[model samples]
Target: MASVALAGCGKSNDAAKPVAAAGAVEKPTLKLGFIKLTDMAPLAIAKEKGFFQEEGLNVTLEPQANWKVLLDGVAGGTLDGAHMLAGQPIAAAAGIGAKAKLIAPLSLDLNGNAITVSNKVWTAIAAKLPKGPDGKVAHPISAAALKGMPLKFGMVFPFSPHNYELRYWLAAGGIQPGFYLPGDLAGTTGAQMQISVTPPPQMPSTLEAGTIDGYSVGEPWNQAAVKKKIGVPVITDAEIFPDNPEKVFGMTEDFAKKNPKTVQALLRALIKAQQWLDAEGGKNRAEAVKILAKSQYVGADPEVIAASMTGKFTFAPGDAREAPGFNIFFDKFAGYPYYSDAVWFLTQMRRWGQIPTDKTDQWYADTAKAVYKPDLYLAAAKSLVDQGVIPAAAVPETDGYKAPQGGFIDGVTYDGKQPNAYLAKFTIGLKAGQTVTPAGVK
Candidate 1:
């Protein structure tokens, strides 16, 4: 177990910390699940830093094998909640995979993923990349460099930000990333580059073995590639989709309903953990990297974990660069569970034929609302504000939808309010009324 020290506020040394409201913690002991990823820092920090204890709850943080097993643990009631892919709750609510009613009241972090290519692919494209004034390769490299090449890429899971971001980057570069059809879950119906699943920790080893030419995954794995001199990270998710929602704190609706107060207590601790992470421009991140490097957590070398966590990322040897927003926790209102974020994932699911059929804009909105519970998020935030644990300004004033924004690599605008129109704007991918079949898109 890691030791986390609590920071002091402006109050007197003798001043006692504020306690939770009467009966705010319905369940005193809880078990949470998480995969071994740097983005899982918030959960580990909350447990180690005594935030959960402050809320009158005891949390046992367990590391699961993969996303599927973690989701299963949450849905089957073995875990009170877990660090989950943003799409897990959305996919579950949409009945695309697991048949459970899961809801996300909190988003874990944003922009911790990157696309890395093996040494062979890097060698092929490095000479062709445009040089900057420094005479080095310009960043945010387009996936067009891989065009006309027979490449197999790896993603962490089917319903993951890695998959969607990889596809978006490929399509933006005029490279077909393939699609999924009914009875054909391979997601490679029409492709320029074939993509398949590779567990996060094995990405570097898999790439070295020539099983995959490249991969899109979260931190440590990407950095591990650079450390081992096996691959170079070409583009980060932040460059692909600036400030994209990455992971969420997910639990079944039944759990949330049965233990509403317990959920509130958990959220309070998580919010505090987020604040500590982004404090002082990540002054606490070094300490966080140590915690995450523990055997029970991410269990990677602290140096590799710090590659992205401490506001810097390495593309290749001697290619370190400032990436202040690489793994955001609380800043930029990252902890808020935005309905627009959920809608964006739904759009990707539809774009790739995972949805299998076209639905009305209202259906998109309804589905987003059903899975993303901003109401619960706000309730927890308000409690923390009232208790003076966090500032009121940390919460954003909104109707649960961000205004139309354009930060994509493709230069296309996305407005959550207009789902079908957004789908239509894509040059590639299924348009309105299109369904994917095993034979091909129909």
Candidate 2:
């Protein structure tokens, strides 16, 4: 096993180590894949800050060409685990990928995604936002403002949260958002929607060419719009899915079962890294940006990363606002991977015809328990907690989230235990055994 030194508050956990340390097991070296984006910060942070080493893990961090390549790496086991969309694992297990079971011991990070509109759309919408108390135009400009305007926006991929999130925000706010052509709807034919996959780096140029009016992507592309003055970032993913779990560290379920301790140790180290990020109450953000800038990872300018990661964001030309917690890495109970968060992703799967038939609340729970291993997280937490590494208060009960989840842009109250009821509440999209079958399937 690789020897990893773990500490918190800059104090060595040697005393607490023996108290909470689990049995020393063989540490397997892992090559993890990630797409170059700010939300991938947790993996970079964990690797750079020696959190992985502390948990007796030897980890290799690699940048992926795109989301498809990243998901393929983990599914094929060329890479052991990767920073993957929460939906990727769900889609994979439900036979979307290779029909393999993928597990997430840790959710990599949260809330660094946004939908940016072209210059024309921004100019069109800018006329409508309420002139705020500060003379700056109001934010979270509702999609209602885009009514009757023929808009063709871009999303990274069909099954991506970017697509679902963008669609959700538009639908909830009374916009008839256009759809992208889906490559395959589980063998269903005909055009799915208008959304076609545009890489994050190409999103701006595509919009500028009038090929698309807007795009949903993660930073620094969103920040690039502000820095380049080409377009404006209208809504952040946080606004769409408040404190939603964005990415997860995924490994084949067989690997997790065969190498259980390694997965547990990884979670322990990552949790420590996450805790350190918030130490001294989150004064380490600047340092985090530098690590993300190294050529091996995101390879974006540190300033672009810092703009969103820090407390400042540019909505339009010279329209800066204080958007603290916009790309939060570890603060605000964001690290706790709630089953409700898992269910929300599943709900979206059903919403967009990806899931086909509606499933029960228990279906959500079963899928969640299969992918999100809270028991493993608890084991890691217990080890760190008993070692006195993190304050008991810092580590929540690890049982679940608050009974009722709020902060959604929509006025929906989500309870993990009641997913079917939640599905019934939506006005748009499918619900309750509503299946979309291919034209000739019957």
Candidate 3:
């Protein structure tokens, strides 16, 4: 396994001692993989801040080139687990891409992605966008601004939240981002705006090269564009879908079954790292930016990473705004792996024709339950609580489902229990009886 030499970050006060004693961690030495994204903070912080070491884990953190390589590493047992897109394990269970019985026992963080457009595209649409009273473009700029324009956009991976959030943002504005046909792996059939894949770090360069007019990705790539003067961020994923689940610590089900104590130890360390990240209203973020700027981790400039990670998001030059919720690590039950979060991803999979057929609501629920092991999350959280590491309230008292949420850009409500009903409300995307074909939606 390719490993990065981590720079030292002295242990935080909260992480100085082992919080939970998961007796006899079956595996003390382990290797994990992650893409170079800001959402991978939990893993990096855990390693640098000595949280992993406190929990008796000798973990090696490696940065993969892209999401596909990271996912394949985790699924193939080359790496033990990874900072994975929330949809990866769900797609695996649904047989959408690769087939594996992967499990997401804990969610990593929330709301760290944004959609950015090239400067040329932004200049074209800026003149038409209505301005608010402050003489700036009104917030939550809709995809309608690009209507009737033939454009191509990039996302990190087929099963990435970036893809679904971009599609959701576009479809909400009366544009069809396209669907996956039975034989069409590109998923551009019937597309009004073509969407394709690009690695996260390459987004800015890809946009600058004119290969894609825009892209949806996690920081600091979006921030990198604004810094490099290559593109302008139009909208954040939080604006598209509020407090949405993003990345999760994913591993094969077999690994979890065989090494239960090790899994709990890993989760405990990650939870501590998350709490440290969000501590004291983000006072620690400056230091975190420096740590993540190391070549082994995010490797972006601290200023660029801080643009989003330190409670502000920059849309364009001179348009920075306070965005405290831009990158939520531990607050508001961020670590708990909710089954509802998994169900929502499954619904999007079916919505975009990745599943290729209609599935009963029960199927969605069963699939979510199979892939999202909230029982394990609770067990890990409980251990921390018992040790007074975290407040009991920090652990959400949820029934594996969030209340029906309605902060969507389009004002459509999403109830995890009613995925089909929620999906049917979309003006675009496949309907209940419809399926994707090379010709068109059938």
Minimum summed lDDT over a 10-residue window in model 3 is located at 1-10
TM per model? 0.96, 0.88, 0.96
lDDT of 1 by residue, 1-442 (tens): 1122234322221342436665667777899999899999989888777777777777899989888899899999999999999999999988897889999999999899999999999999999999999888998899988889999999999999999999999999999888887666879988888999998998999999999999999999999999999999999999999999999999999999989989998998898888888887777889899989999999999999988888788998888999999998888889998888999999999999899899899998999999999989899989888777777778899999998978899999999999999999999999987887767678
TM-score of 3: 0.96
- What candidate 1 gets wrong by more than 4 Å, as runs, is 1-18, 21-24
**Candidate 3 — which pairs collide?**
none
- Put down candidate 3 lDDT per residue, 1-442, tens digits, no spaces: 1111121224763556654455578998999999999999999999988889888888999999988899889989999999999999999888776668899999999899999999999999999898989899999999999999999999999999999999999999899988897677778988999999999999999999999999999999999999999999999999999999999999999999999999988998898888888877887789899989999999999999999988899998899988999999889888988888999999888889998999999999999998899899899889878777777878888889999998899999999999899889988988999988788988
Give each model's whole-structure lDDT. 0.89, 0.71, 0.90
After TM-score superposition, what is the CA distance of residue 147 in candidate 3 from its true location, in Å? Answer: 0.5
- Candidate 2 minimal-lDDT segment of 10 residues: 11-20
Cα deviation in Å at residue 157, candidate 1? Answer: 0.9
Off by over 4 Å in 2: 1-27, 177-193, 437-442
For each predicted model, how many residue pairs clash, with residues at least 3 apart or on different chains? Answer: 0, 10, 0
lDDT of 2 by residue, 1-442 (tens): 1112335532233322222244464545789898888877777777777667666566899988877887778878899888887778877765544467887767666777898988888898787778778887766667777777767778786567787788788777866343211445422232222456787777777877789888898888888877777788888887877766787777888888878777777787777777665555456678878888888988888988888876767676567677776765556555666776777887777766666565767778888777777677777777777888765555567466447677777778778788788778877666566654444111
lDDT of 2: 0.71
